[model samples]
Target: MVTQRSSRVRLEWGPIGADRIVEPDCLAVVVDVLSFTTALTVAVQVGAEVYPYAWDRQDLGTYAAARDAHHAVGRYEAQRSDSLTSVSLSPRSLAVSSGLKRLVLPSPNGSTISFRLRDSGATVVGVSLRNRAAVAAWLDAALEDDPARVLALVAAGERWDDGSLRPAVEDLWGCGALLAGLRDRGADVLREASPEAHVALAAYDAVADDLEAGLVACDSGQELVRAGFRDDVVDAAQLDVSAVVPVLSGERFVDARRPLGE
Candidate 1:
């Protein structure tokens, strides 16, 4: 329990960290700022249900067809699509995609984390820079109803060349953004935060003012920008612009404030 960072809010990196932090009474918040969770946020905000796919399979098209959902392609593929319906892991690709009812977004970090946590007996939530404040507010109300619940904030950092966790700074900033919002609600939660969680919050506060510039300067951000998808990085840098909170229901995600099937 001590290694678990026994606080109302805990912080860790990647899917392995997710496995360690999640509990039946925990809200497992997945933060993947580069694209996955950002895309999920935009999709859910526009009333689309997102299904996380491992994205490492060759049968991606068949997989999407089986689920009756459109499979998101790569960002470069999305950009060349004849229509905006060509969804991808990029949040910018989801712009003007309101008619899309369902999307199978695949990612190595965020999607994998979500997939691993689906059966962990913890409530899973999708978090990004786009909806951090909304999620934090939503959490405040949800936790109020269940006093025993804690927050397991997982930053789905990128992987290194050796397939080890890269611990991307943007993901840490994203988690810190949520933590900053959560801690603002009261002194108790702020005090209950683990030192690691506090580190994340401090990370966010340090560069919240120039987040866009900060993102553009980061390794992951530069990768996307150099690929001619700078728009994706720019779109993701916007903070707390979305009010929609995506909660994983079954295998897909839906808006938390909206009743299921509504």
Candidate 2:
């Protein structure tokens, strides 16, 4: 009997920078379960071709008007402000649709990361627990084609009064898991990862089932559950499905690009 060895993989965790410049040479995987990425993964799985627009407040009106958008959608952060109400809303279906013929996204954190990476030389992909498996497979194919030197993992967070708003550890847990799987398969290419990656992976493993057992534990996960999207979360964590890597092309997420496998 022969035993397979675990492939060595490395990953790093960090925040989006000011310019939020995403290195084009590396493959980027953006994860935000709170809403945008979560909804994006679900919507793609649900058959909606998601097109992400700029999160800049000024850009919203222009895009909405040009697209003949009927509704404008955003997060509680933007809508909570007295002046931003005209363009913000909760992360609901109506908010998802907003008033546009197509979806116009202005999220507090997720959209910012997505927009920044909009033109990186490397391919940008959306990920959440729901499409983890699919993403892993997609990554495998990318590695087979051209191994990446840097795999940037961005996590989104809330805005606080003291500028101390950082992404939740729960969010990192998922990223760590992805990093772990990437390393396990030797697909991350660069062989660079955070020392804490294993720690985060173990923590998430301990509470992986909490996604179902404690529905209200995580803010975004809970929000989706309350919004009647529990099924989305359950499916999001499945690990692998289509193996179709979802990449960001301009403003839309296109899966037509086959994995390196094909």
Candidate 3:
């Protein structure tokens, strides 16, 4: 209970934080700016039904096959191949993939957290730097609809080589982007935002002038760059470009612009 940051809005890092903060009355927003959620936003923008999967799931391809969806590949895997059979967790890949109606996206960070949070009794929403403003607007409308609903912004930080949480700054910035945008949407929401949420808002204010630069200089960005995926970082650095609010309905993330049933 103490770790839940009991307030109208809260900000926390990693999967453990996600478990602590979310409940049936909470709107859990998962932010993975380096790729997962960014890719998710792009997929949803193109009207694709996205299924989030565990990062360690060995049956990702099998799952996608059963559902007749494209199993998202790693950027390196997609880049190394000439096959047009699938897209990756890179926003650029999903952005260019035509007729992408269904996708089973997996990741070490965002997808893992998202998959686990599906039955957590909270309304899970996906966000990244690209669609923070649109999601904030959606959140404002959501607040109006259910005055009792609370917010939990979870930063799905990366993992170290040993598979431990690395607390990536890119995700922190992504969470901050959403925090500041939501605060700008309404005054009431700010009143009960946790202190940790304010800390994230402060970070957002610091990077507001140069989000692209922030992403370009972060450790995750450098790693992705060395791996030949700098374009993915740039794709996620954009702000408010997408109005697609990815809401978790059943096991898939459907764009909030359309009905969840669709």
Ranking by TM-score: 3, 1, 2
TM-score of each: 0.94, 0.69, 0.96
Considering lDDT, where higher is better, how would the candidates rank from best to worst?
3, 1, 2
Cα-based lDDT for every prediction: 0.86, 0.55, 0.87
Question: Residue 230 in model 3: shift from native, Å?
Answer: 1.4
**What lDDT is obtained when candidate 3 is compared to the true structure?**
0.87
Model 3, position 232, has a per-residue lDDT of 89
- In candidate 3 the C-alpha lDDT for residue 262 amounts to 58
Q: Give, for candidate 1, the lowest lDDT window spanning 10 residues.
A: 1-10
lDDT winner between 1 and 2, please give it: 1
For candidate 1, the per-residue lDDT at 188 reads: 57
lDDT of 2 at 79: 41
Off by over 4 Å in 2: 1-22, 54-56, 67-72, 75-101, 183-191, 219-244, 256-262
Query: lDDT per residue, candidate 1, 44-153, as tens digits?
Result: 88778888878587987897798888888887776778875677887876877757888888899999889788888888999999898899899988888877678889
Whichever of 1 and 3 has more TM-score, that candidate is 3
**How many clashes would you count in candidate 2?**
21
